[model samples]
Target: MKGFTLIELLVVVLIIGILSSVALPQYQKAVKKTRLMRLAPLIKAMADAEEAYYLANGQYTPFSSELDISWPDGTLAGAATDDGYLRFSDGTVVDLLSGSSYLTGSASAYVMGKTKEGIYYIHYLDHSSSPGVRSCKGDESLCKSFGGEAFNGGWKIP
Candidate 1:
């Protein structure tokens, strides 16, 4: 009689539980989106560096060392390779898509990363066609959140 009834306390608890249930997933989604957003600028920087390198050398190189990129310490891991591919500490991979076709006129590169949930996000830069084209390849909803348009079984991020 001095305090709230059992039914009243039960209702309050249920309401709080419902609110938390709804909020938790949204919070998780926001965190994931933030992480993905951080990658975009980094990928774009690499693409710009690749373009500059190509202009000077007339061909793209896969190694980041050859490009005018000062990668942050701990950003990259593992030993260097001659194959023109680099791996980031976060498990993302950047590959310079170069070959005879590249020297013939088409020069391009791509950065690909996979989320813990097995979703793949890819950013592609094609100097021959569009110069800087970003693309995504998983979870249509997630891709659309990045302002992507569906194309060829994937989303082209704008």
Candidate 2:
């Protein structure tokens, strides 16, 4: 059996390390973006489900029943539930009553932002806060007029 020289092994290890170092952050960011992106579809799906529930009952709200949810795909864990309240691993909240964490519950309606803290927004993040690209709401600077312009009383999603 042939054995590799220490120098050769060191060079190979160094090369692998360099490649990993350069690619790791990019990989991490991509994963983060992908995870954050799931919020959109999740929001849409939840909104649709909630709308259906509302149409059937004439009031909009995610019933306090077991909801089979797949949390952050890229970063968050899988097979989550809203049986009690929407909660992220980092303690971010997303329930209709507990709109204190990431945008999950009613936020499936409006306002969205992704940070290391996770996707966050408020109940009725904004009225003018369009669902287009780069529409900022829930941030104090934008909702400075008091009563939070995005805080539309009751649900907004249909």
Question: Model 2, 16-100: lDDT tens per residue?
Answer: 9999999997687566545444455645454445445545555444343423334555443323444334545544444432332
Runs in model 2 with CA error above 4 Å? 48-85, 88-117, 121-158
Per-candidate TM vs. native? 0.74, 0.44
lDDT of each: 0.64, 0.42
Native-referenced Cα lDDT, model 1: 0.64
Q: In candidate 1, residue 122 scores what lDDT? A: 60
TM-score, candidate number 1: 0.74
Enumerate residue pairs that collide in model 1: 62-84
Candidate 1, 148: how far from true, in Å? 3.7
Quote model 2's TM-score: 0.44
